[model samples]
Target: MQDLLGHLRSGQVCYSTPQGAMISGDSLELLAQLPANSVDLFVTSPPFPLLRQKAYGNEDQQRYVAWLTEFAKLAKDALKPTGSLVIDIGGAYQRGLPVRSLHQYRALLAFVDDVGYRLAEEFYWYNPSKLPSPIEWVNKRKIRAKDAVNTVWWLSKTDDPKADVGKVRVPYSKSMERLLQDPQRYYTPKDRPSQHSIGEAFGRDNGGALPSNLLSIPNSQSNDAYLRACKALGLSGHPARFPIKLPSFFIEMCTDPGDLVVDFFGGSNTTGRAAEDLRRRWLSFELDRAYAAESVVRFIGDQAPAKVLKHIEQMTNGQVLAIDDSA
Candidate 1:
């Protein structure tokens, strides 16, 4: 296994695990080196195709689709037959127009039609804290509603990927809780108005209710350890950091502890940190060397981790970042 992963660690190495490695390089080049049928869970939020360009590179609409489709083929090869690839993609607006871009929609089609990956399910991420986007049309013109939702596509190698909904169930609603308390009174079996039958076993406690495909999570990070550490080192945090909850939900649902997780476009390495905390081995690739190096700060705890300290030294050219009590 180590020999197969040699190419993954060819670039600047920030961290290492039994089945994980973090390398700094273009993901397009790095992905090819990974052994086929190795990764169990692949997750990432690549730079969205925006009307205006972001500092981090993002190809224009049609080109982005072509690039992503080609990359999807490589991503599929890196995954096991029963593995899943969960991607969080945001919608884009047409240049200087109120109309929406079909790039995201077309990308979805290419994933199925071109790449042959099955769309297991589509999830929506509602970021309550998201600021108004496409400011011209949304705020100035007041033509469209606030663009606060992102599409999360769950694509799998096969019809059934390794997923367990029970692993990511949520707490039951108050009505369901009351029904569980007294099945005879509140939970009698009956045919519902929606033409759905309520079975007697519905009252059984299955940990919690299965969460809706739509996820409500805020992306704001005020004074977390990662931000504190980055601030102390004068490193601006990754502008587009996905909330930890977003990846944690899918990671729990699609993978088990010790499974392999890969983030091909590892901006700030949020997916890597989530996998680490979940005890799942992870491999990550980032194009930006500085961002890749600064990502090690996510590992700092109460005390500085020796591994991260060493990585910081390399990233800063021997300027060790102090992961003191502030973080």
Candidate 2:
């Protein structure tokens, strides 16, 4: 069959090196082709069904959920018993009415539950720049809401999923330090402090504290940190990108060196970049050929110590990482 992307736009695979891999095709179909129980981590944000219009888009809400469900099952079967699935999904808005995002979650949760995958934990990637919602004034009463965040649902197949929370943990404020001193104080802990939360806290020194779910990292579109990190790594910009710190934190928290990381959507290849920077092997898939080409360029440019494509040639074999998956 003719490649959909090929007919629309030329698609190219990049970085045959073990450190990076990219493919151009339908994400769901591509994911199906992957080996089962192969990846250690799967991180991605599938396009939301809200803005239901695209050139080559399949943005129908029910269809989107169904599509995701089919792959979710395959992902469950393909993931290592300990592998983690990190998904980011946007909520919905319609005709001045606020829509609950749980629909996506509900459909996804059903599959994960049916597969018997354990609900390990979840993270909220708060977008502080999100637009505010409208309010209705009824007989002097008022209501106001903001579109300020997206949820990062972290899932695992087993109860003891692999996570090095230290990777995601940020530092405590001076006030937190002073407050912790008084163990008996009745304070509402610092908006979910890292170590204070009931989860794995990786990267903490003897004196360092854990991080909170209310992450302060803005999306890469608005944050210079991603560009800075990419520049330091020797790559260019990817607009639909997440800060390296986000994925880097996950690498630190859930994975070790020589582990395998996969990002099916692979939008800007942020996940793969993070994996390589941390000394782990990565494989990514993107339906958009243009983005896939950019991923390769970015990977090679940043991974090579010098501006030499020859260095990428040195990478042949990829190390494999393992994860736990449940029903």
lDDT of each: 0.80, 0.60
TM-score of each: 0.90, 0.70
lDDT of 1 at 106: 85
> Tens digit of lDDT per residue, candidate 1, span 1-327?
356567564555555544455677778777777789988989999998886778778788868889888778899998999999999889988886788888877888999999999999999999988889778778888889999999999999999899998899988889989988998998679999999998988989888998999999888766256776777666686777888888889898999998988898887888887887787888778787777777877766334456555666676462333332244
In candidate 1, where is summed lDDT lowest over 10 consecutive residues? 318-327
lDDT of 2 by residue, 149-191 (tens): 7777778877787877765556667766665566346254343
What's the TM for model 2?
0.70
lDDT score, candidate 1, position 209: 94
Residue 211 lDDT, candidate 1, scale 0-100 = 91
